[model samples]
Target: MSFGSFSLCKELQQSLIEQGYTKATAIQQQAIPLVLEQRDLIAIAQTGTGKTASFSLPMLQLLTKGTAATDNHIRALVLTPTRELAAQVGQAILSYSSLTNLSTTAVHGGVRIEPQIAKLQSGVDVLVATPGRLLDLYTQQALSFDKLEILVLDEADRMLDLGFVDDIRHIQKLLPIKRQNLMFSATFTNPIRLLAEDMLNSPATVEISPETSNLEAISQRVHPVDKNRKTELLIHLIKSNSWNQVLIFCRTKHGADNLVTNLEQVGIRGASIHANRTQHARTQVLGGFRDGSIKVLVATDLASRGIDLSRLSCVINLDLPFVAEDYVHRIGRTGRAGHKGLAISLFSDDESKQLKSIEKLIGRTFTQTLVPGFELAIKPIVDESDDDLYGNFEPDPTYLKQTQKRSKHTKSGSNRSRSKRR
Candidate 1:
């Protein structure tokens, strides 16, 4: 379906055309009409599904026909889980509302509150914010929910993962009881359904399965390497494959920083984004990466949320996440907007549990391959005794089978010479 068929305002339709958004994504086609009808909705969508546009487009048209916000008041609120996501949602709303006079501003922590306060005091039609910062602004009387006509909880699952449930309930209590509520999540887990019951009123649900062709847009492969040699393997792949604009995921902030440092020492332009970094630094690094001045962007999973890079063709999992669902979100960073992309994971023996969980979740076994010199040095020991199953489960026959199969796919004789800084 096309944006024109959504019965949107002319300005929004024009904006969509100019943005090159011709056909509506499945999420957009399904959710936009519900939002336009002012119905409470629960959208189950994954990353890179044009989920932002689904709501933003309808919101722009709806807000254009409503009463304008007064000082210290907002007409609509979009709550996100991370600063990056808040900014991303805010930007999408702003971009879609370009042809209209609707005002939009995003507020989040890690930045000065005084400036956000100023933005809210002047009044905004749409306020996109993180949970904590929104509450802080509310406590300071910087914004009011009295004028709120619509409430959107974007990335509901991520908010729960980040432990924003209490804040969400608090914010809900403060909102006008008679208003439209929309909740969007990657999954409709019990926690999300419970939250939806609390926030939404007999909402309509729209779910786009992640196992669809959207996932097929990405080519996935695994490289079996030692834990310590992941950095070397990453560098080798970047140089050997001549990859540019790679987004690498690390499990910890310290690990992300160390990886960037290592990459820089070898002449690869790299940067890191994580919770520990100031918002300013994170924004600067993202800007550099988007402009091609930075070859690689290393980020923790939470920090990577809401990062939308159209040209990012590759994503590397330096360390697999403990949560299997995160694997889907990480690779979703690429293969976006129907573009073909690549996702590579550096698998180690110790991460067998994570690997197994991920394969089970995605319903596909990754093709394991070994880089010539970066192959594992010590093989994992298998405990065949049935009695020791629960006690020693790290190295089972499944892991050994995968490892043994990996040896057959090792690349031919090649130079092990590591790339150096030119």
Candidate 2:
């Protein structure tokens, strides 16, 4: 259905028209009406399904008709998992609220707090924030949620995965219980459901897509190569295909950095994003990648959660994620907003368990291909008996030795206690 059927404010309709969004996505269609009615909502939708606009539009309409209280108390507060996402949500609110008089600001860590405090004190109608920075501002009394009308948790699943549950609960306790509650995520796993039970109040549930599926426009494929040769093959693919923009996912911070170094050594423009990097660096890397100045962006799963890249052409899995659900979110970087994209995974024999888990999660096997010159000389064996492949891969000898030492100490302590008793 068209966005016009939602009977939004004339100015909002005009804004949508100018932005070239005539039709509503499935989640938008179902969610806009409930949100306009001022009901608590739990929206389950994928990454690129226009979930941002679904709530942003309705929120603008709600706030425009209401009056602001004294002390510039925040009217709406949106909590996201990452700084990039907070910025993106703030931008969306600003763009959609252009015709209105509402003011919006984004607060997150890895940046100066004085400016954000200044903005908060000046009065903001909507505040988008990451949990850590928000807590900091709250503790310093730089922000107040006393007049909060609506509370939105965008990407709730990611927040939970990032160990933000305690932060979310703390924020929830500080909010006014009467405020409108909204929770949106890509999937409703058991953990997500448990978290929703605590946050939502008799919410209207909306699920736009199947729980375990990625976008249909993305073509998934796998290239079987040796563990050491994956980076070389990645450079080969990007150079051969002349791909302009690519997002590569690595399992660790070191892996991301190493991938970036390798790509640069081969004459490809690449940047890495991880927890160790400052917020400014991450933002710069993301901006460059989105603007097509950077050819490849290597990032860990946590660092890449909030990245919303429009028309991103390709996503390469340099290291398969240990969790199956992450695979959906990784490839979701591409095939956004009805655009066709490709997702390629570089898999080695050691990662077969991860591959199997992903296949089980997505309910399909990826089509495997072999690179001509970089193919594995000796195929690595996969052991079906080991369920925890990621945990069992003891690559660090020092760590294993430490574990053994700890065990021996514990046994000796038990024997000494028995001898003393005798």
Top TM-score prediction, candidate number = 1
Residue pairs with colliding backbones in model 1 are: none
Model 1 segments beyond 4 Å from truth? Answer: 381-422
Instruction: Estimate the lDDT of model 1.
Output: 0.82
Sequence-dependent TM-score of model 2: 0.89
Report the C-alpha displacement of residue 228, candidate 2, in angstroms: 1.5
TM-scores for every candidate against the unseen true structure: 0.90, 0.89
lDDT of 2 by residue, 1-422 (tens): 89999868888888888888888877788889989999888887668888899899998889888886446479999999988899989988888878878888999999999999988886689899999999999888988888899999999988987899999999989998787888888766667777777777777777654421236788899999988788789888998896778888999999889888888887888999889999898889888877888878888887555788768889999898887777878998898776788999999987887787677555577878897888678977777686575453322233223323433432211101000100
- Give per-candidate clash totals: 0, 0
Model 2 clash tally, residue pairs = 0
* Ten contiguous residues with the weakest lDDT in model 2: 413-422
What local lDDT score does residue 94 receive in model 1, on the 0 to 100 scale?
A: 86
lDDT per residue (tens digit) for residues 53-102 in model 1:
98888887899998888889999999999999999889888889899999
